[model samples]
Target: MTEVAGSSNSNNLLLEQFKDICAVDTEIARRFLTESNWNLEAAVHLYFHANDPEAIQNDDNARNEHEIRRRNVANPRNEAPANQNAVVRRSSESQLDTWGAWFRALLALPFRLAYFSLREIFLFIYALFGGNALAITNPREDLQKFLTAIANYPNSERINWFNGTYNEVLNEAKSSVRFLLVYLHNPSHQSTETFLDKVLFNKIFSDFVRDNNIIMWGTDVRTNEGYKVATSLHELTYPCLSLICLRENRMACVLRINGMHEITPVLTALQTALAENQRFLNAILHERAQRELDNRLRREQEQEYQIALEQDRAKLNERRRLESERQDAERLAREEEENLLIKKQHLAEIRERLRAELTNELAVKGGETIRISVRFPSGAKFDKIFGVDDSLEKLFNSVLVHATCPDDFSLVSSYPRVHLQCAPDWYREFSSVEENFGGTKTFRQAGLENSLVVLVRDNDA
Candidate 1:
């Protein structure tokens, strides 16, 4: 029974693999990158492993189990496996559960390790301002082409699928950062536009009104959503406005154009968006400038008041100095007068005793005085330059987040479209797991998807 269950699970896994490789469309992966809110790393992982059989199987099992538990909790017959006579089904289910757990755990290890390694490398490159956007391409075709190109490059090493160098991926990412262009076509003629009967113009008009930005200027036709017969086509273009505004909050207009239609509208639409954003940005800068000007004026007023107070202080000091000098002069005159009076009295006393030998002597000594001035010690000036504050790292991180893109593209980098959120405790766990798997690229090459999640979660925290 166990063997049968194992066979069924294996078959299911194989089928899922086939569908991922063959059946699922590639465009969906690109769409998900923008919609999923996953940073570039996570998006790349999702795109690469979007079709993995094991992932699908696990998701299916989880959903199925939840549904069964919710619906069958009151049914005793369904709850007990022992009461069932279905030996093959019971064995297969048990085998699937046990094997799936082992497989998931084994598969997750390499992914986790790769995540850490790649992020470390990526962060280093980002420090150099050399990171680029992830290009949305047909994975199978693009991967093969990229590999072929790498093989032909002079002094390039062979790309190891299981243990590919992070340098190689970095180079590839830089070179392949192109936007995916989507063009819509008419459903019936496979052309740009067609005349449809009984179409509600109001519906089309309402869609345009809700969308705010209009790509189709001067066209009054509205309510085209419920066409009797409509067709569409897809093509690649350089001016992918939809991709550009993928992360923006504002709604963008979607225009219908046929393959044979002129490229003028596409160019015009992009030009309009550019002009609008430029005007908005300029206005913001102007407002900031005015605010700065007002602040400067206020500072100048404060400085003027300070200068006036300093002048008043100087005048008061001058008056004090003159008064002190006058007081010292008066005191010196009084002392000299008292000394003269004493001298005269002493002379009179000496003259009265004429019989005795009268003698008077005045002694004076020459003396020099030297004065030495010393300055008191203070803490070293500009102390913050040398580890005075432990929060320097935090300050630098804040700067990094807020700094504008430098003029030098070589010094400009985009933040990862995806940011990981995880707890500090999770990081400790990841660190220990990484220690055992260090010094190898086995983790990344094993699977980019799992690696993306594990690595991003660890680093982001």
Candidate 2:
């Protein structure tokens, strides 16, 4: 119930505005506004242009067609019959008035030609000065020249004119979604002075226009640009006000108040028209703002998502690197342990073999026995008996069987302190040595006497 009452109040407000703007009865305004889906702007646009007084002179059949359509809506059950009757009536009217219309058009042809000639001239001028595809002259200069003629008087109230050509002002109005108030002034006409003095320069009218944010633009009809617009509008009046607004994606004439008028009526006309159409501008503003906000929000979200994705990917990669390093360390530790076990087992085998060979060599304890003492770095001593003809290899093998012997060592003589190359690889440190520098020499063959003590040195230590 509240929604319906609110809707009713809204409709009533729309009807009042439409009647005031179109200067129609309440019933007429209600009917037009309803036909236009309660859109004041569209409804007002339709009422003015459809029932244009100038249109009534040129093509009155259009008004008849509109009336028929309006009646068709009120009595929908009789629509087909009404359409048939309309078709018959139109056929009769065409047949009866064809010759008269043709003759009238023939008479109007010369006037139309003159009008078209001026229109073409203005179009060429606009192409040059109105920021066309290629502008040849400065539009600001042209507008200034036009405004200079109007502001020639000292006491004149100057309107804040748009500093551009008609084409530029139209484009601006469309872009800004504002009403373009176009005044085409004819200097020779009687109404021009009245319009300028009473309406155009009136404080109330100016204030209303300023408050409504209407773009004021004017040019003399004698000028090429203005002449072009005048011819295009087909207005015969001296002082013409063309109220143009952005409608259906194009700047179109919403209402035109022509000839002489007082300030109040002019202000009322402008106000009603603006009230009828400003909703379109508001809607456009809202839509653009909404689209911008949506785009901004989407961009922000995308940036955040990308940032989060990068952070997660970085964390995952770090974890993988740590896990890989841990696994590698564990593998290396296991390999090192296995290698140590194998080395220990190999050393035990070598010790057992060395003991067996040493026992065999020392068992022959008969001829020319030489006893040598080996002193280790840890102060451990090993006294081994070898035959005087036994090779130094027997001494090294006997030392190896002892648990205190180092894995890699060279024997040094105790009294002489000479490094004896008894080990197989001991000569590797020398650039040149005797051919029999290794363990191939026997203890007696080498100059070693009985009970010679040698020191066992560890190579790594």
Candidate 3:
């Protein structure tokens, strides 16, 4: 019981709200509110307000009268006694007219039947005599011909029509992110000429349609294609206009106007549809922009990654090259050190052989002895006893071992003015001794058998 009472209270509040918005009879407002699922706001929006703001504010009486009629139509059983009485009077008058028509038809039935029969017979005779049969008309072909005729007309050319199939136009509209405006024409419609001349061809209307990003498709109902579209849209009137838009991946009619020839009504309907669906269009544009931005950012990141990868590869190659060069240099240095050691060992062996030979030769008993005198650059003189078989290198060694400045001086024979070079080792023996005066000559062979004097002088001097 409490739930029921609460529901009643909600209903009462909605009805009161509707009444405040509509300024009409309470019952009429309640009916409209109920029709809109007891939503006061929707009822006011759909039934109370007019498309034009000025009309909504100034046409209270007209709106109330229309609402009253609508309310009666919605709930005839709940109409007032005066309306019921009027309906009863009209019902009686209709019954009387129906009987009178039946009586008159009963009297004229034979004559009418005979007239129709005679007309059929005459049509058959004319068809047989004229040597022509009634041609079966193709609605699609008729529609095409009609469209061709309209296309050739000077006035019809002003309105731009999409030159493609209906599906093509719809697909284009979806891809281009625009609205599709479909105009269904009927050449037989009485108001078609007026509508095309006064409203559709108006400069303002044409410009608006042309400037806006809208796809306009038009077809005549006489064609197979047009008939299919008309049937699908449930269009009951000729010269119908429908604004189709994509919503949530489906095409839906946003606005429809039928049998309207006036410029104001046509323009108003078009404007209202565009204004209401602008939000959906904006959402599509925003989503596309966001997707493009994301794609751009992803591309940039990929390019940066590619650059970084190449740089890393180049660095790795450089590091490997440097390591290879370092290994080569180390190998070369080791080889050079080994070669130097080998040369030193060979030189030592030659020097030891020379020393042993000289010692053996000098060990012979009663061997000839020579007195050799060597002088240093420091005004010092020394005398030594040396065997005749001894080499000049031995005497030079004795001088070098005792001299204070051995490296700076060369030994010279005073009478012959010959300089004797000192050999440091056997590896350089020939280069150290004096050339042109017998490089391998011994001290005795150089005519220094008895006593010889040798002087030391600076090598540079």
Question: How many backbone overlaps does candidate 2 show?
Answer: 0
Model 2 stretches with alpha carbons more than 4 Å out: 1-141, 154-158, 231-236, 316-461
Order of all candidates by TM-score, from best down to worst? 2, 3, 1
Q: Write the per-residue lDDT of candidate 3 for residues 430-452, one digit (tens) a residue.
A: 23334443354576676667777
Per-residue CA lDDT of model 1 for 158-222, tens digit only, reads 11221222223323322332111222212222121311111112244224323433221110111
Find the 10 residues in a row with the least total lDDT in model 3.
85-94
Please give the CA lDDT of all the candidate structures.
0.32, 0.66, 0.63
Of models 1 and 2, which has the larger lDDT? 2
Q: Judging by lDDT against the true structure, name the best candidate.
A: 2
Say which candidate scores most in TM-score: 2
- Candidate 2 has an lDDT of 0.66
How does model 3 fare in lDDT?
0.63
